[model samples]
Target chain A: MNFDIAIVIAIEMNIKVQNISKSYNKIKAVDAVTFEVNSGELFGLIGPDGAGKTTIFRILTTLLMPDEGNATVAEYDVVADYKAIRSSVGYMPGKFSLYQDLTVEENLEFFATIFGTTLAENYALIADIYIQLEPFKDRRAGALSGGMKQKLALCCALIHAPKVLFLDEPTTGVDPVSRKEFWQMLKRLQLKGITILVSTPYMDEASLCDRIALIQKGKILKIDAPQVITANYEKLIYDIQSKNTHGLIHDLKNYSSHYSVYAFGEFIHYIDKNVDFKPEDLQQYLEEKNHSDIIIKKAETTIEDVFMDL
Target chain B: MVFETLQVSIIIMNKEKIIQVEKLTKTFGNFTAVKGITFDVYKGEIFGFLGANGAGKTTAMKMLIGISNPTSGKAIVAGLDVATQSDLVKMNIGYMSQKFSLYDDLTVNENITFFGGIYGLSRKQIKEKSIQLVEELEMQNVANNLVGALPLGWKQKLSFSVALLHEPKIVFLDEPTGGVDPITRRQFWEMIYTQAHKGTTIFVTTHYMDEAEYCDRVSIMVDGVIEALDTPKNLKQQFKVNSMNDVFLKLARNIE
Candidate 1:
């Protein structure tokens, strides 16, 4: 098979990434990114858009090389063991890439066959997902719904029973219910002792993992359990809504108590620049400020809220 | 339960919903993408279509929009049986996808004209609505720019505004917020809110859990079935979860 030089050398990586930095000319796509996922445990790369989540995933998955760094996965150095890494870890790219003309069953079987495995051998591992696609097993993958295709791709990933699973934004375009379902499946796979590393732009999905590394601009901002990261959140949060919401956002950002005021849902998520002020005091201030139809309530910090604060 | 503070009275109960689905099923071969899912979206409501990655929300939405056929059960969208009146349903509906159903090579104005023309709007109406939509979306700066050059969020809002050019009964959005920034997500929801106020039912799918709370009702799918369908508040109360993410986890995991 004709292949690129990097592809020929991608076999020996076993989770090693050194002071790796890469830039597309002047644009720092990934800057000094370094991390490792152990042999087993679902590791999440969580962040918002343009946070270089995909770039790092691609590099570790052996699809790209950093301008300067050394990395490995599954004891196979990403470069030296390129082919070995490619065959060992099951990967589902952010975009659906299965044969669109083939039915769900055909796609699964083709993938399993490629990996020299049969559906019966890995039946238990992929049973949950395959069952969802079973009825659509005859349906063209392209015709499958977003959620259905997601499940199909997941089943394909598990068909090989890989030592690791690399899902690049698997739930990005999926529905909330499906996102929940996908995460539950990941937990099950994690229990089976498969080291899984998934990247997502959705910070909310970070909590679903056992541990996470919050990355922004190709740098590791924080690495811990979701609850711990949120616990690291120091500012008091208020979900504030008013009759004049537009005016409220403009004013709250200018308010003396503003630590960070960003629009969250139907209200502005206000963080107190002055931590000493109580909720009632702020409410009183809003009332005194002639804020009409004001509803101010103390709000718990979510993963996204923490991301915003930090 | 979720968002019960919205203050629904008996008065709220009397109004008929625009899209009423009951036991809607879409089975392919032997697998069911959407199974026995039932929900109601009232007129002028910002109904959120939510689920995990493969939770049949899109299947259900596709059936409602008449793009995909349902294997069994009944779904009445915009007072028309989707199974029998697909054409009428299509005429009364506009759909936007996560990828944003617009011609990337076309100029913004040209894309608007193309979509408006397909919806059977008069040339004059197309021109007028394009100008109006351009003003509303603040896309005057990119009126003739190639849509591919625009950001994902701008294309999303533009797709939505284009979907409503003919005043559809309900607009179905399939993961319309994907790959967009949080600020853009907020702005898109604001557009949904504004359209809802104008009596356009906004049906949207999203992965963001916090966004679920904004829905008038949310249905959770697990293993190709609508396992939980209720207002976000009701699901929260039923599952004893503080946030929609927790509620989703409880139902999706506990079921197995």
Candidate 2:
């Protein structure tokens, strides 16, 4: 059985999209977007709002028809075999679309019944996530906290054991702690041999996925492993810090050799235009501008930097 | 140089407190959302209100904005008591949230005009402000476009500009840059800095820890209590962490 599963994983490309394009009122929402997800791999569509992440998900899940191009999920054509695709794939939209007036347990049971399955039969598939929601089982869905509501939504999405899961911006406005917990849960789900495709506006979450496509304005900027994308950044970024952050940013922006400057966490990320840039010259310049306690060092490039550069 | 020095000293001498709260508490039947929280916000300060999802940030914010009544506490905003002068409190401060701010059916120009009218701006002033705002945002071509048709980043920026139409003493922003792109998010911060430079106190909340570092001071709430409040640098040092994200993780680790 293990050998048979290995063969299935090796041969199956769980999701494939070939030049899918979608438009709304003459505005291109998804422009020639194409990518694939391997079975059991966690792929991330990383982008800000209105970057066509949702449009692509809708087309893949057979909710919306693409203007052009074709896509497949779990070897089922999204257009010709939408019903088959719907039954096998789990989708959690960006918005909370669950029945708010119903109790948590009732919502789960409802979803289970619609999928022609019993909650008892598939409880083990969502045991880890459902365990957290069990405490609020009797309470109405609308009365739960933001984090609890998100947990309940995730439980309903997983009620039926799905082969592939698609999550749309699941952590957009979520707090950092809850966001971290949500990603951990996704990792566990992937371990259960489920191919997961998740979209997020948070650049930090890109690194947690096996592969990420940095998308913006309905176009794919880059696609690769997070580390590979950062490694390919062909610039020597610098972390510059001083007492007066506002003044520091202003001075750095005015610096003649500066290529790009922006606030990154506690420090300002600076990239030099000149090839042979020295820290001493910049340090001397900042000191002249009355910036005290200047600290400059070579900073590591991150997925956010790459996205901004792209 | 002399005028600049004078302006600097004048600002220092006036260290005016725009918002003050003493033992602020709010309860819903048996549960206390805000448990006697106390904090002060000075004029021109960028105060970062940080908290978990259910840590009473919204409850405290509602009380400060004068939309909800507190069960017990003393709070003053713009020299008026929130409990007794909620109407005046509502007039003295601006508010913008990511979820709801602008009308989708209204054009950009109409939205600006509507907000200006609501703030009691003269018709002439509204016209002039709308023209200037359109030019500043480089939205002249889309001035007549419906707000819903505009991009998310543009909508956020316009929402912020509308909030400042009447030039209130304080502007409360709830997750203003939640899902915007990186460059646009920084641009929004630049707008915040410009308004703050003009002595408009900014009370903002966000999930981005990096943005937390940009604030002058930040207060983290946990389990309906103010767990820590300090500048990002000082908080990092106190917690022996290198970044604000770590400080937040350390403080908010108790919640599920």
Candidate 3:
């Protein structure tokens, strides 16, 4: 029985949280939050800024303690086994924390040395990302561009071959192209059997994760696969367009049946309160308001829509 | 009096160029940050300055706002030369950024009053403006509350309103809607529209492609150069892409 229990523990390397809560100055930062991450799963915590995402991250990484409840990472207690947890997990904070004055190569070497490892030992694990930074190895980290700096940070995080990786808002200010490239890198890392927990404010990134937890105001609104969350959205949204976008938004909000209206890309995403909403009805209303070049069609629901509705 | 009226009419008829730049360039040491970028912003136009990370957007913006001197170029902002009359240029423009703009320890009313005084408004004018500003934003309840205690969305809105206290001709916003909730982000854009409708030239920068679509015209920078500048619609049609995100990807990735 003892041997069997040991085997189960070895294979069940996952994260588990139960009713964890934290407060600051009597204001609840995280309130009874509970979730779990299976081994090798890419889990995402999606929310806007100041939604208690960073506090939860600090708690899980053993940098801070929860006021109540308990949690475990890699089958080790976060409070009792903090030393072990600290060695096994890699955490990249939302702010840049690397040594800015050191050269890129020096920063990498320093991190590797602290973990009692050498760059040669883990070259294969970070080969794909390090190649991009090879040319800038001699330059100071502060001199590197924003995208390059992020790549360097990720490389340092993986130097020890950590079992789980924690990334907070990695693409917050990155442009669309760099954001896309960053997601691709995460996908490749996940294929190597590393469990990843990432957070982002950009709602579109939720679809890229295996599973996501939509959080706001220190509470989880929903948790499920990205497809399931969007598929379960019950509202019928319409893509609205016209020559004068500003005027179109005002007119839609004034319509009697309008439930919600906001700009989405080039079109205004409109949701009607009526169950039997008709496209022709909205079309006629817009025409009467002198909106020309009108185009209305069924719009696909996204994570942003779900978040706003919640 | 007749001559003054005729001059004002002529300015209005000519489209009233609030900002005009010609081959603006800036360099530091051996690196050229902004390389001979040229563009014009008319009165009441919401011009989006976009680029990938470290694509010279910040550097270009600094020069245009008169804080950083250009290596070589000509930029006339509010009828003052940026390089020669930087102090005068600063007085004629309002600047705001997501990272820093408002003090955390000051109350909402204090911030408005403080910024009003710095803009050279008289004591009587500041008093009247503060009262009107507080009511306009519907923050009567939190007027005396410290800005640190407010939510992120509310702080952002209040910061925007404070920037407009002096009613400068042009407002420079650096990622104003970043990290705010969806509803608040739209509400912020509505404020922008209202300001533009009142003839305030808005020069803004953002990473959100959807926000780029709302600009009257956009300029995409790559490798310290303006690769594309046109209306979002025309750029999409030219690139044969469906959205501005695709247009940005094609442009940024192609250069890489």
Q: TM per model?
A: 0.76, 0.97, 0.95
The candidate maximizing TM-score is 2
Judging by DockQ against the true structure, name the best candidate: 2
Model 2 lDDT tens row, B125-202 = 999999999999999999999999999999999999999999899999999999999999998998998899999999
Compose the digit string of candidate 3's lDDT tens values, residues A38-83.
Answer: 8888999999888889999999999999999899999888999999
Candidate 1 lDDT over residue span A147-234, tens digit each: 7888889888889888778898998776656667788899988877678888887777788887788777668888888889888887
Model 2 Cα displacement at A256 (Å)?
1.4
Colliding pairs, model 3:
none
Question: How far in Å is the alpha carbon of B12 misplaced in model 2?
Answer: 8.9
Candidates sorted by lDDT, descending order? 2, 3, 1
Model 2, residue A203: distance off in Å is 0.3
Candidate closer to the true structure by DockQ (higher is better), 1 or 2: 2
Indicate the DockQ of the complex predicted as candidate 2: 0.79
Interface RMSD of 2: 0.7
Give the TM-score comparing model 3 with the true structure, all chains together.
Answer: 0.95
